[model samples]
Target: MRDASSGNALSDTMEVNDETQAPGASWLPRGDDWVLQLSGAWRGQRAALPELPAQDFNGAVAVDAEALRSWDAGLAAQLWQQLDPLARRSVTLDLQGLPQGLQEVLALALHDAPPTEEAAVGPAHGPLERLGERTKTWWADHRKTLTFVGEVLLSMGRWVRGKSDMRTSDLMWQIEQTGPRSLPIVSLVCFLVGLIVAYMGAAQLQRFGAQNFIADLVTVGVVREVAALLVGIVLAGRVGAAFAAQIGSMRANEEVDALTTLGVNPFDFLVLPRVLALLIVGPMLTAFGAAVGMAVGWLVAVGIYGVTPLEYVYASVESLTLPHVVVGLIKGTVYAVLVALAGCLQGMAAGRSAQAVGDATTASVVQAIVWIVVAASVLTVVFQRLDF
Candidate 1:
């Protein structure tokens, strides 16, 4: 067939490469010039240009896209792949024969301009600007934390009113996990700590012939500070990480979303029970750990040291006052709240992946530990100020 526009006929039959199915390309001879013909809808993931022929074009080539109905970034990418090398090798590209939009796009793709000065150096920020940016990030993070805390408080209020989705069974299970099951480890740790305290105190007190004072040291130290602090650290590692892992896995599986779709508040169903369980069980554990530690201290004092059992018992009883026990219980309560908050916050904010769940679990443990320590320090300072 003759070309009607310029009366020039295609002399050679060019077939589209089989690899490129729909949006294909072929080199057609139009008079003395070679026209690269592009046809079909050059869009979507499957659209691609044909493979480059082994025969190199020494002369300029014209792009004939009159048959192309539509195009997208995929076509632009393909055109760049096929035409960039030829242009780099000194072959001129006649984009005028292509669509206006395609021609303009190709111009940008084929250009070899150097980077502008602003782009090369980038925007400079002073120390004040950097500080402002950091402050903004800090504010954003703390705002999210405060919002989560407020939501948790509201959930607790709802539970108190008996209008929440929190289950009695879930609370009992969490209590069992954080309480009785944790006793062996807590007992072992507190026993070892008491042994060390009693041994060290006896070693120093023997020089002064005041072996009876070892009872005072063990009782005051363990009940007022050591037992509560150790229990908090233990639970931060044990229970806090477990909460994060459980909730994060639920988040990854879209179970949290499913709960929300069912008009259930995840805070009520998931977080409140864990927090309440810890709140109820933590003080009990702290008191138990303190009693265990004091008993071990008594054994060490009366067994190894020459202090009489009656004298050691009398000293320990004198040191174990109401204020000391109250302080330890209060610290345990605060640590429990912090642990629950850290674990639930990280789990709820977790991303939807296995790695993300693992990361959230790790972060929850670290955050719980840090919060426990900070709260301990603050409580210590306050207690000291009050002369408790």
Candidate 2:
């Protein structure tokens, strides 16, 4: 007979003996049991056994492999194919005649197989559930941020007590990064801003024949606000992003974890130097920016507004008081702290991926800029209200 599955003759490899028959299997009904009989060399050529016909039998099905000469996983696989049909008819298998090794192999294959689609049922989530999950995640993030801030503060306290593990060289290097290297950009931005202010003030004042006041406008604006604000924004984009990318890469490479494993506080070893450097550099940059801005204003007033060089210098100097410079420096110091904290916090929290480092760098710059604006607004209001 032709095997329905492979369209091959079932007796192709069968050999008949004078007193016994060649290898094959036969199914027979015996009362409440189904007996499957096997015989001969059930290997190699016999591996491509025909699929079993679907049956509607009840009770137990027993395999009889005693007369079999040899077998392999192929035979085991063929036998396994018969199991599901028996299971569908509520029949239990009697695998007593199967070799222990074959039985174990079959058992393992069945055990590791993925669950059927019917077994993967799950409940669906509602919109409220998703919203609650998001809220919880946000709260957790805020809590972690506050904890990081507290750790940084504690590190600073330890440094003040002369018990910090931070290296002086690291502090110096960070100061160089945030200070001298940044002067050109700071000076350029301040000078352009001063020129713009002088041009605008001269335009309005010239209409009223008071163009000489352009010096006062540029001086007061630069000393009290514009120069410091411009420097803060520049550093936020430059130093803050650098800090975030550097620390985020270290986090990704597990170097920060290594420091922790070695009993070194990352807040002290990594964060303190950055914060202290920015704090020291912020005022210095602000002062330099103010000077450059005043020089630019002098140029505008002398060259464009028909004011004498000495008179422009005197008006610029007279327009700025110590209190105005002090306020600018204070704003710079606060802006520096905000920028450093934003970068460091985002860096330490970065995930272990290239994309995450980039994201943290972007976030650091954005957060630093936002905090600087907010700080400047609040400080401006307070300084004005106090009549400074």
Candidate 3:
């Protein structure tokens, strides 16, 4: 920002070989850009420059044909040839994307001549400033649409803390609605998952004389990954879709509006109980699924390896640590929040149309599953780094 030298123009006193030289070896003005001359110099130099002025780019692009009458076509190319990418980067920044004020300045300059060095800064601010301000206001207005989230969670805490008029019946109803109703599918899928994983582990470890470790392998792998994932998939389709559908149905019927008319908070009465219920049931179902998976795996292990049931159980238990179990529970809890939040948010935001309700339900399942997988993978990486 300060002056490069307090004195005069620079002088290249050293006599370097002229033939071994760069094409456009001219010094830029101290802070200015792309204002090069054909005569190369510091001060005392015979420079053969290839650079062009910053202000003449568009003028060069589709210029007046009459302006070229004084010179041949070869002269125009020699005078204003296409720049290399690096030079184009610098040159276009000053010329091609000219602001309105800069465009006016440039137009006026064409009527007269190239701008004097002092007039190079043609405009102060560009159009992006107003665009930025509008973007800020747009974000602020949309943020209010999501204010119901915090209130929903607060109402959940109240229900958890107190035993009164706090939707305990609804909580049980939801557990019945989501977890109990999903038992058949959950059981079947977990069983298949267990069978598949156990078969794979056994086949590989058997080749290495580590067949007995199959129980341990199945135990750790199920608890850490498959169990939590099974619970999450069920929650995404079962509990999540249900939340979206219920709230969306209420929205369609204007029951949520009726609650506001009666001075009963919609978030507390509707979303709170559902969210709290899912959080409570998610960890329980995950543990239940993990137990079932391990049971199925043990059956296969005992039957195939001729290992005793007692030995398989002992080996599986011995192979696992408290940390692995804790990690699975933690993952389940995280998935519960994401699934419930996604479903409730989509449902509450859902349009009044029946199709909108279905859309919300579908979106909730997809988003919950995606976010759950991402969170689980990140947690897995973090846990591996922890080396526990």
Segments of candidate 1 deviating more than 4 angstroms: 1-125
**Model 2 lDDT per residue over 293-377, tens place:** 8888888888887999888878877888899899989988888888999999989987666767898899899989998999999
TM-score of each: 0.69, 0.67, 0.61
* Best-matching candidate per lDDT: 1
1-388, model 3: which lDDT tens digit per residue? 2345422223232333232232233324423444332221122333333444454333223121211112223322333333323232223323333234433544433331222222232232455754565555557534743576677767767666773244568768876776777777778889999999998888898888887888888899888778889988888998899899989888878898998898777777777777777787778777878888898889888988767888898998897789989998888878887888888887887766676688789978998999898998899999999986
Q: Quantify all predictions' global Cα lDDT against the true fold.
A: 0.83, 0.81, 0.67
What is residue 110's positional error in candidate 1, in angstroms?
A: 31
| Candidates arranged by TM-score, highest first | 1, 2, 3
Clashing pairs in 1: none
**Residue 3 of model 2: what lDDT?**
52
Which is the better candidate, 1 or 2, if ranked by lDDT?
A: 1
